[model samples]
Target: MKIHMLAAATLAMLAAAGVHAAPPEQAPHARVLQLDSNSDGVIDRTEAAASTRLAARFDALDANGDGRLQREELRGARKGHGPRGGHRGGHRHAGIDALARLDTDGDGRISRGELEAANAAREARAGADPKRAARTGHRARPDLLAQFDAIDRNRDSLLSRGELRSWSEAQRPQREAEMQRRFDERFSAADLNGDGRLSRVEVDEKMPRIASRFAWLDENGDGVLERNELRPQRGR
Candidate 1:
């Protein structure tokens, strides 16, 4: 259950992009349902593989790297360095509330048409009274429509709960791989002594973000990052 530096870095990137001011939380019940596919009370490698989110961080969550995640390990994954480190409870609830609003038909799913309608409503409101809209926080994000289209995988103009989950699952591996490649490049460049691990000074100079959370990543309090500590586990 050691802190996963790459995950933190990814969250940082999302914040920088203004996707959300804080990490979005996954509701505990939803998490169990999504990750524990078999309902066996635990997430094994096979189950985790079915989820892009879980699969990407499977290694880190499997504290012992035993190819399975017990309840304890799952709990650890939720623990993070600071307010912005882990998912924020308010954000999670807000997302659920937003989705509920978008599912106008109460079918528990959102269609592109419905989403567009909602966006239009928000836009109209904003145009009529910009100050009121701003004060009420009802303005729509310009990219929201594009984002909805991207997640509608079947091009059926509808976004079912399953479709949304599938889109995320599909994107997880590519994202994680790209992050891993970047981390490797950075680690190699920062390893001044050509050693596999990085000392505090090396991290301070080369990876300021990681350095800021050094205590969290140094799992053993050894003041250095073992090669494995900075890299994703193989085959993940």
Candidate 2:
């Protein structure tokens, strides 16, 4: 009778604590599955190399220090904390995401006709539901449409995979320069002392994102970040 009573009490205690003997982890994400060549349910460094975005973040996302990215880590990333466990604003490959949206036929290329159709569809949807369009993060970019003729080098009215690649390559240096300029502007603003550098306190107060990466960015153990020491990561 005493043993039965103790078991019942323990079960109730466990229920209250929300402790389970074995909580099931969710299956790996579809993107992860596609690269999970070994079928072992997690992405290793070799498998991750194929994805530039994942490769750049692999070290940061490996929460267990086990060199393997599990579903929970990926989920955490989606929720915006997985990158070095920091509250930095969301990071996305906007160019890549935009291109994927443009390639609606899944044929790995975009034609003028397809582009028109996509624009028409987006306009119709936006007209029908202004709020939905305003809320969506993937709204069509007018800048790309404006440059369509210039990007179509062959006069074929189609954007081949290579053409897109070439355009992005051509734009890379300018984009990187712009990113650096913006970083400089922010750094200058945060440098309360006008010393051309940011101390920990300044970073914590003005730039929370840099605060999370202070130790890493503060090279030479100087306890502050110089302009050269704190550059934005490319393709972020």
Candidate 3:
């Protein structure tokens, strides 16, 4: 029930925003990781301050008393697992907030009936000001709006959850391949010394974010970042 609710809430928000889920590699903890501005693969106290809720529970989530949040620590926190196995309720991941917006009767939950009504409301608004709606809808990724008509299989002129999910799944492989190709190009460009790895100095000069977390990403403490080190950290 909890998973389904979250999924529906997320889908509704995505449909309204006219954006789709990010690639799989970027989904898990991607929003939290974005706070790692230094890109060292963990969220420090300063970075945690970006989210007010996360900042308040930082110490409790810092299981090792390191004063920073590793990915697992955050994952545990989101799942309501505290350091002592207590439930840390209300870890914000946008689901509750999304529900609040869509739950028209303030019943604290969104039913299929409610969702359908909300969809109709959105379509009416879009009809009233299509040019303005188009501009607001795809603010996350303007490119998605270009493909909107094609993805709207029902021709209702509104993106339903199924259509968007199907489109995103279908585009996953191509998106991942393109991401890898771009990463390879950037890595080659950053490896100025023709080496297979990036020295601290090279990363600092070429990639400021990696430079901030250079020591951490250098898993072997070899004072450099290898190609694998630069890739997204999955299941961290």
The lowest-lDDT stretch of 10 consecutive residues in candidate 1 is 89-98
> How does model 3 score by TM-score?
0.42
Best by TM-score: 2
| Residue pairs clashing, model 3 | 40-213
As a TM-score, model 2 comes out at 0.55
Off by over 4 Å in 1: 1-107, 113-156, 185-189, 192-196, 208-216, 219-223, 231-236
What lDDT tens digits, residue by residue, belong to model 2 across residues 163-234? 765665566565545544644666787899998888999977776533666787677889998876665232
lDDT of every predicted structure (CA atoms): 0.57, 0.60, 0.58
Most lDDT-accurate candidate: 2
What are the TM-scores, per candidate, against the unseen true structure? 0.37, 0.55, 0.42
- TM-score of model number 1: 0.37
Name the candidate, 1 or 2, with the larger lDDT value: 2
Q: Could you tell me how far off, in angstroms, the CA of residue 39 lies in candidate 1 after the best superposition?
A: 40
Give RMSD (Å) of candidate 2 vs. truth.
12.1
Worst lDDT 10-window in candidate 3: 90-99
